[model samples]
Target chain A: MRVPVLIRRPPEILSSEITDEGLFLNRRKFVQAAAAVGAAGVAGSLLRPKGVRAAEPGQDEDKLTPYEDVTSYNNFYEFGTGKGDPVKNAHTLRPRPWTIRVEGEVGKPTTFDIDDIWSRFPPEERVYRLRCVEAWSMVIPWFGFPLADLLTAVEPTSAARFVEFKTLHDTEQMPGQRRGVLPWPYIEGLRMDEAMHPLTILSLGVYGKVLPNQNGAPIRLVVPWKYGFKSIKSIVSIELTREQPRNTWMVQAPNEYGFYANVNPEVDHPRWSQKRERRLGELFKRATLPFNGYADQVASLYAGMDLTRHY
Target chain B: MNQVQWVRRVLKPAVFVAAAVPFGLLVKDIFGGTLGANPVEEITHRTGFWTLTMLTITLGVTPIRKVLRLNALIRLRRMLGVYAFFYAFLHFTMYALDRAVFSGLGLTVGAIVEDVAERPFVTVGFTAFVLLVPLAITSTKGWVKRLGGKRWQRLHRLVYVAAIGGVFHFLWLVKADIRRPVIFGAILTVLLGYRVGVWWVGKGRRQRAGHVVAAGASS
Candidate 1:
């Protein structure tokens, strides 16, 4: 296995250029401005969600969830399955000293330090509505770069069709791992194209600060358009594979959770209706949007496929 | 007034107020903005908890009276069961309202009926609540006089079945972390166990008495 670092890509193939043509043309200027601000140590403050300054193009303008809600009400089941369990029990997690093993069918199978990945891909604020499979939603201002950038750096092989993410599995820190609620070392995966989608981000921060431990600190996947569980937390490994990898939730209950796991209101989970969702901190439930309101950007990915059957 | 009258007028009213405190607090929390994030869930969770709590308490009334000889506690069981139904009603209403936005028609009979039939958790909970309706209605003195004591008692035994359904509803709905529902299940087991034990011991006593009478007559 070989390890690689920050392999620069052609300017056109950049994940940032894939979005808007205007933003693509102004990429150099944005990078220069970001570099200058990054040098001054004001990067953190600049990325903070305040007014229109933190609003990114092609993202939701919904009111961001309160920092208290974003931090306290979490679904990181490693700590525990309860909504409040992570807040109370994740104190034992040591996020700083962490390394992610990036391997499997890539040109360079590398072990990258969490900090290295953070610096290599400068964080960008993306306000996303995170809808959990359990029918609750929250609009979170996540700070991270695209997963495409990370995959680009590692250089996936042509044979690689899926990317699997493995979460931290320390029983000492994550008390819930000791019990059999879910298979330990929770696993989640995405198709190669879905993994390379511009909206799929490797989140490191929320509300402009480094993530709280309970909210998957160090590093985590944030696939905004999919169910929140698809965005695996406290990631420890990224493996590119030829075959579709088994996801934890899907493995536990296949009928309830499918491999696609896209946010589709039309296809209901076996246990409950998916047409509506309770947005956190909101009084009334809101009608769920197809692909979590990212249908324009992501709907084509599933063209000609039977979503109900896939679901 | 004497002690019996004092207990009837003052103590019974006190129990009623105390039993109502949870619902009042829930209402206050809704208006006070203190139910925290996801107020719908908070409302659902709290009301569900109180429903099960009151149901368990109601099931324990007979056992408590028999053990401690506090027969006046029998008067309080009706109020306790009513509170359980009241909370269950609130729980069902909040759940409907929570899901109503998805329905084409808002809070209509069709939508509720569809949900009750479609979702297993809702089905069980709705069945439990529907069972409680007759119990609450027949709890009145007039209904008791009309139905007669034996038939009334038999119909009221359905509360035990309703209580089991409520627990199963809770157990089935949880995504993960079955600890809370499991704890509730344990409590129900103990309450039901006490009732079965009392019946078994009484049957044994009756059998023994029959044998003794037969033996004396033969001798």
Candidate 2:
């Protein structure tokens, strides 16, 4: 069932030119490979190939997109906007030179490099639905440790009631900065309990592969219950604080964006109805599920609060 | 008016240039695949907006000609009209692909078209768009020669009706934020109003003169 494409292989281009143009193909080829691999994808299945171990049901990692899909195609603004932009642009990010600074209401304020942090917390697999503010939602199987586990290791002080995360602020890396739409070096925050919630994950990879730069490769937060923006990406710093943290989107359009940023049907945006969403892949087929249908798991978090206010 | 002609000659590109700035940015974002999520709507809205914009410009051409005392202002009409068709085609495609238009839900064409009517904005927008299809087809130079100058001018007056329909289409489409459509509507009204006022006043004076001549002859 495979058809061969005729290609006349000429002499390879020089290394510098190869880096310039040839590097783009690696990302393009990654997509081509994913499409090829998808040829074997059975209907409505999460990539359970023949003879290879299928992820068992109830296993969080079982229903995840492969890591190659996760890291390469992402919405991590720290790297860039498009799923492909990250892989193409993240090389310039200097993940090696990156170090996360932690402070605010902590007895032992610690600043750690990417190496020290990963070696300690390690990566765990969690299948979570990422619902974007713009109405598209996706089911991603992310590989990362729980925010609670990481916080426990760091020992947040009792005074630390809020946890704020900051993305790397380089006008060079984050092209959105050039436009100044929502203040650069995007910042997001969560209440202390929400930050420590087991459902909250600091994503490292997806689909059993490393994270795509666009998908917040290297590191990003994944809050399954809330809208995806609450799950910040390309994190460069973490601050433990008592006061409310300044978030980018909420600051820009307070009426449209909310602090909790949960997936709720009752809370409609200024322009569009939140009552229904287009499920990914089923975008042309099925309608979206409400609370992204994790209401059973996350509804308790917003039991008494007026969702309209939080919305 | 030599200076005036020079300015307008420069401004013809400037209008297209101004129009293209947004298209370029949006295109770059889309082509770079940087439009993020819900991409289909992003492209739809962008293209739809330019459709209305170019239509507004096309409608503005005649008034601009009269107001500026420059006959050459009429020259931009053809190019602007074509651009309107270009963007309008994009807008039409977006809607046709939407669930409201051609649903993969196995809905009948009658049902699909009915669903579009159920949404008032879509209904009005569809009406305006359908009205433009005839205008677009008749814009050819051959069609101009075929209809003859007077008939063709009469036929192309359909562009005025299309412009009004297009603005109303945009106004109906939005649920809130009437500011944008209202601004566009005001501009379109002024453009159309200029011609209507001139026609009405000229007709009234001619009628008065005819009455006087008839009375003089009778007396």
Candidate 3:
């Protein structure tokens, strides 16, 4: 019998969405043309930092805040204080041809170009919940690698107890720096354990695109579990110190901000509550999770210490 | 209608719409996807700013009438005060939504309660809104009649206290760049200064009148 022969199709290996690819490519061209015309003399290649494709099943599922919102609404006081000011002002910031000096307690004490660092640490997609002390949150799809990789490469000495980060201090570019706003060239620090945490990353982009100037272009730190300020932006230097370094916020307002700055719902800021946070896209405020919902990964680091007292 | 009657009939309503334009524009912006990236924060800030603006304008009415002898301006004071309360109410409700009440869904009463009780900025702002409630309720002619003029005046004096509270609430909440709040502080000071100037001038005139009458009676 030539009758009923079963015909089954092979399982599909890849599924790609059929959209207007031409339009996407055209828009990218437009962006390149605009960047080329800008006064900052930013080359197209330098304007967009190409990163390795992060593996699929990425945090794309974690309800991202709109790219517009992520770029427009920022708290980069280096640009200005207003929520919208950074987007308007940070356009002047030239992030290309950047170099970061890694000194203090490191054996190499190297000064590496931003491109070199990017090569060393291939990008990975990390969707992290960024909670600001101001009680607002955003789910950012950060393209970066574990800071541990960089720390490992640098080879921190045994005496290295803390890692201090410093941002670039160019008054002409960073207008807010001209004004004495919290002592310019903002500084942030982390303990050795916190620095090595896999969750801690050095971010170059967000939402699979090169980070916009206001979102801290080129490179910035992303300590997901800690308060957003702890993730200092537009990093220029990394120093390993023996003592706990003086963080900018803590030095400015010790009573309000602390060294650890771990996202603790229990430890309320002096002026505002930390119990709840308003996620950017949401209308209602949700209860803030301990360690920004990374408690499982980072809580172990703070085992014996009292977070409340430290905060 | 006569000029006086026409002004009474038409001008007040125009001012009412003018005062409410900010709120209407805000609502339209919210729906039109133009309230910027952080819509909740945009809403909160716009409403809060309008509330303060309305309160400042309401406080300026008496001074404007007395200094410029534009007695007709006094007619707009109650409307201004009511508008201030309307914006203040929106400001308060938006705060609940912006800060503690909403996430992606709707209201969370637990977070709201915790914020009202625990956060100093929220506590001060909530208190200021609560204090405005009585003044807003008594704004109507019926309520004013029920309270009686002297008692009503005494009750309404609480607006100054509420204004002070509002300024303090703003001062406490801002992280840095207190320039805007300080400017508002200056405006509030000037408004209070006018009231003090009037009171001092009135006190001097009354004391002089008393002295002249006493001297005339002795003579």
Candidate 4:
């Protein structure tokens, strides 16, 4: 102590070494301004939808296609045939106050209000790779519960072998319906087993927010293992049927679009090769995987069937 | 200035700038990152569109000259044809980059050869582009003089075939919406029809003149 200070006195920091309070505050303000600008720049490039965030980690290595690309570049013939037409014209769609009619070979035939389905299902997020038959693809973060859960809730009867989904048929709401684009009230279907697969979902939202109208607002089907067209949009009805439901594309061009529109690279479309697909936000075309890279999860379902024949 | 001088100095420059506008705008869009998510597709489409447009315009020049009695318009035809070739070249380049180079195929000619051989759409598009090569090379006045007017005119008629191939290439590629390609087909039809009508009228006039000369000689 007095003889020799037990604790050595710490060297004092010079006034120059200590940052001035005004300068520190100014630097923080500058940093905040820079950060705001950087965020704005990212938002501008992405044209991000409201309330949407980046997908949670470990979902995918491939970057999520920007929200703008997902919404704007749509193939919803219900809106129009042009790639950009959906975003331009889909505002006419009324997504709220919606109901989905569930019937046909079910124990409980009922129409579910959109909100009721939302609360009952309570959508969880799933990132999926969407492959289009047109040889383009996107990675999308879709929010939905399993389609099996909904099917179980409806209590499908033993006679149910297929699940048929239909879109709204109003010409006023969907202007493309005014023209004979693809036989209105676009229809899609899946085998009961395929529908029951956990990978299959009835999507309520995308990018962690309510879906934009162009991306099939309120509710749509998301079959991650199949082509984008197989996942029909804006469902007004879901029917469990005995026979397979003829889908819109198959009805329109039977030779071109098959009933089972699974993503098969070896089975090419009549008009073009399905071997390669241009991923959104990428310059080069990548080799398309069988079942769009979800073969591990879904290959067992089609173990014996010849995909080429089915495709 | 006289009309010809004005056309040479002012109108020609204006037309050149007008023709280049689409390409310039495309370049701006490319650099500005406004070509949307799939820039290669956008580039391919824009170039293809302009190629078809330029071909149509080139084909329309003769008819426009005859209809409006503006003989000076003939001067614009070669320039327009060259512009069509320009766009076609860009379109083909983009395809090669997409299918061969950027596709991680290592920029081999073999990859491009395979594309042209295997893909029917590419086959037709490549044919159309190949058809433009001789025409583009011999576009100058010197080559026109060397080939002689009749031979040069006969050789350049290949443009009609190229135009047809271009239309079919477009028609074959589309999935469902054929409206745009149909419109292009319609325009090409009207232009070719007009050319045939003019040829028929010229043949009739030549036959009549020959018969009159024979009658006078016999009398």
Candidate 5:
């Protein structure tokens, strides 16, 4: 039987120098295409650090079509508002040949290239239950290993109680960012322990297809247990810090969106009824499930706290 | 009306088809499988949009008639109001089905009653729609002749209430931006303002005429 669930695509980039494992190392096409993209990125970003253009040939390019199933979809207000606007507007993003600046409260301060970071963590295919803050959900098969692997590489000290991530902000490309409609350079965070959770994966791609421009090309954090907004898209920086980082939703409406946005049917959004959610594609009326039906795995994360209060 | 009446006669069918195209296309789409995986949201958004559009059109009739000096265009007002309710019915269908999980299969009445009681936005919107049903049923020339112009005018004033309700419905659903709702509010305001302004001006003219007649009789 074909399971009605989401499947993630493989990354366009893999290591050119194959590791001894040779597991995905045999996938050479992914590597060469990545190099071509990286070289272009270096030439472009070096040319104009604050520049944008119609998605260059290998800058996570795809032809515009009116109708197609969205491989990556989210309505996270912080990552530029609008449902379909992200990918259409994020064309000027310089994703490849990039660097993730990891700092603060960590034993080692390490800045790694995109290729090196991919090698540091072994990639895995995980089918996660995705719940949106709006209450609807989908099951996505994602590619990438545990975020815990990234934590281990950085070696966060005990004082490193939170992990905050940031997205690149260019007013030209991300017009929504230019507007004060939302705080720019969308920020998201997790308690150090939550960041280290096994289910938390730094997702690279979906549907066995490379990251679509709309879906946060290159890399994004996918925290399946929490609401979709908790998972930031198109990540640029990851820092281990003691202080909590400013999150986008909370800044917009503190009462409605809490820092810990878990998928609990009991806790409804302030403006609308949360008791029921309209599942995407269900037409009009479909009942919502609790914990997005992942209660078995993630229920332990919020065992003691009053979710209604935090929510 | 020599020229104006001819235009109205020509536009009658065109107007009817234009108003009906949405319901027809929606029904055809359901069968054609053009609606994506989430068809209910698709249908609801489409229906709701038309409901608002029709309401706006109904409100626009008087303004257009006044501005263009085409008083006969006012005849289109009733048909437009009826179409607003018709599209509203489709929007209600999609919302009901999408929220069916809240009410189990075949138990829609209870669910409907319960949801309206709990959700005030839906409650007000549905109430506005329910009131329009009677006016729609009584829109015939026979009913108008029986009720007389005064009574007919009074009964049909519910369109104002329905317009207010429609604006509120748009206001409640949208979360992020307030721009769309504000635009609808401004349009409704102007439509209502025009009616009051015209009535005040007409009333003053009649009072002045009565004073003139009384003075002339005394002389």
Candidate 6:
């Protein structure tokens, strides 16, 4: 007998949900052609919002941050610490021919080829508001499938309580790893429930094109309710563990960064205020919301736990 | 032309133009839409960087003059220090506008006061800026003469303290990867170390001179 469905799949695509086949096929061909020249060419072509779906209900209604900003202004320490460093340095990262090994506390441990996973779960477009701990925010349209689909396929054991992710550790490709800026191969984790949440997606593309190398090419986690750092980048391996896994920032500065990095405006970062955030390209700063404004759906996950203490 | 005339007419103006280039470029970038996604942050960082850089160079003036025997370089120090203050003022203004008015905090003094009081980085940065204010005001020749050489010299030493504060402000602000701050700290250490070395040698010389005077009188 088949194992029970561990997590819900995204709802079936309705007849109206389908796009014009000819237009979709042409767009795909154009993306492939751009990809042939180089990643740089693809970057220029993909930035235009052509054939992108509208924001799903409950997604942020704010204007999407410019693609240049999303790709240029990143906090990927594996590439470098400066916001612009990733765009300059991430060209060293090779995204194709990548594989993710899913193992530990799973009934069927498997290594998934990046292409296979792409074909297996056709990406769905999602607009999410990503708020950084530094009090900057962005509205991004990410194209990817629910991560629950992967975890369900692996069939997590009952003992598994946390899901841990690891970025690639090649110093040649990721030169920033050579410097002891942070513990190498940047690691992040989420509670099993958080991992299985419908909002958590394994993003392969953004702005209707293949993910830019700077913005965690190949695959990255996008947990909208959590701080941007919680959504780890360039994931190479995933492990389900019984104990809560210590994330990179948590390891680096335990007092400042904690396991549950849910966006809570009430809890200020020790060094700076978290009550307000400057949405990229806006002149005025806006008051930040609870769970980056997804409290309605995600607040139940931390019902009785003290967020300030966890943070 | 004489050395002083050449410095006044040619060298000083050249240094002033060179110093102002970063600010000019920043304005150009702001207008050209090349400051990237976060232009405010870009402006803040660039201005702050130039502030610290001018402070470091100001501190370097004496060490370089002594080592290279290019005392003409002394003429440039006051201008450099003034530039540091200029950038510090700009940096702080950017922050105030970003935090107070643009942030929708209604330009209340309380918002800025709270930031200075609550954040250690802001505290140190504000301290550096406050220390520079008097130095910049008293930087004119007339004020220097009124204060007298010894008093002015002693007062100007506050630049060292301001430099220390500025370096720490930078060190504390970054989230991680402190290579840049550490580099600034290392350079400051060497500059401060040179001063200590000179002071120690002068103390020894003075003590030896006193001994010679005593021997001469006894004989």
Please give the ranking of all candidate structures by DockQ, highest first, separated by commas.
6, 3, 4, 1, 2, 5
Error of 4 at A75 (Å): 1.3
Top DockQ prediction, candidate number: 6
Task: Say which prediction, candidate 2 or candidate 5, comes out ahead on DockQ.
Answer: 2
Better of 1 and 2 by TM-score: 1
Estimate how well candidate 4 is docked, as a DockQ score.
0.30
Where model 6 places Cα greater than 4 Å from the true spot, the runs are A1-61, B215-219
| Model 4: per-residue Cα lDDT over B57-157, one tens digit each | 99999998899887887888999999999999999998887777656334567878877888788899999999999999999999999999999999999
TM-score of chain B of each: 0.89, 0.83, 0.89, 0.94, 0.87, 0.95
Q: Lowest summed lDDT over 10 consecutive residues: which window, candidate 1 chain B?
A: B99-108
The lDDT values for all models are 0.80, 0.66, 0.78, 0.82, 0.68, 0.84
* Model 1 residue B190 CA deviation in Å: 2.6
What TM-scores do the predictions have? 0.82, 0.62, 0.82, 0.87, 0.80, 0.89
User: Model 5 reaches what TM-score against the true structure?
Assistant: 0.80
Q: Candidate 1's C-alpha lDDT?
A: 0.80
lDDT of 2 by residue, B1-219 (tens): 575576577867876677667768876885675543445566677788888888888887777777777777776788788878878887777667654422324333664476465655667677777777877888888998888999988877877777777777777655333567888899888888888998999999999999999999999
- Candidate 2 residue-wise lDDT, A1-311, digit = tens: 00111111113222122223244335434544554422212123211113332222121211223333444545555554444666677666555556777777777677877767666776654556677766655656466777877777677888999999998887776665565446777899998877876677786655545555566646788877788888887788899988988888888778778888888767777645565454343224233345666666566767898878877
Between 1 and 3, whose lDDT is larger? 1
Instruction: Tell me the tens digit of each residue's lDDT in model 4 across A37-103.
Output: 2111122221222243232212233555666788889998888887889999999999988999999
| Candidate 4 residue-pair clash tally | 0
Give the clashing pairs for model 3: A284-B102, A284-B103, A285-B102, A285-B103
Q: Candidate 3 DockQ category?
A: acceptable
Identify the candidate with maximal lDDT. Answer: 6
Number of the candidate with higher TM-score, 1 or 5: 1
Task: Give residue A250's error in model 4 in angstroms.
Answer: 1.3
Interface residue Cα RMSD of candidate 3 after superposition: 10.5
What lDDT tens digits, residue by residue, belong to model 6 across residues B97-156? 887766645566788899999999999999989999999999999999999999999999
Ranking by lDDT: 6, 4, 1, 3, 5, 2
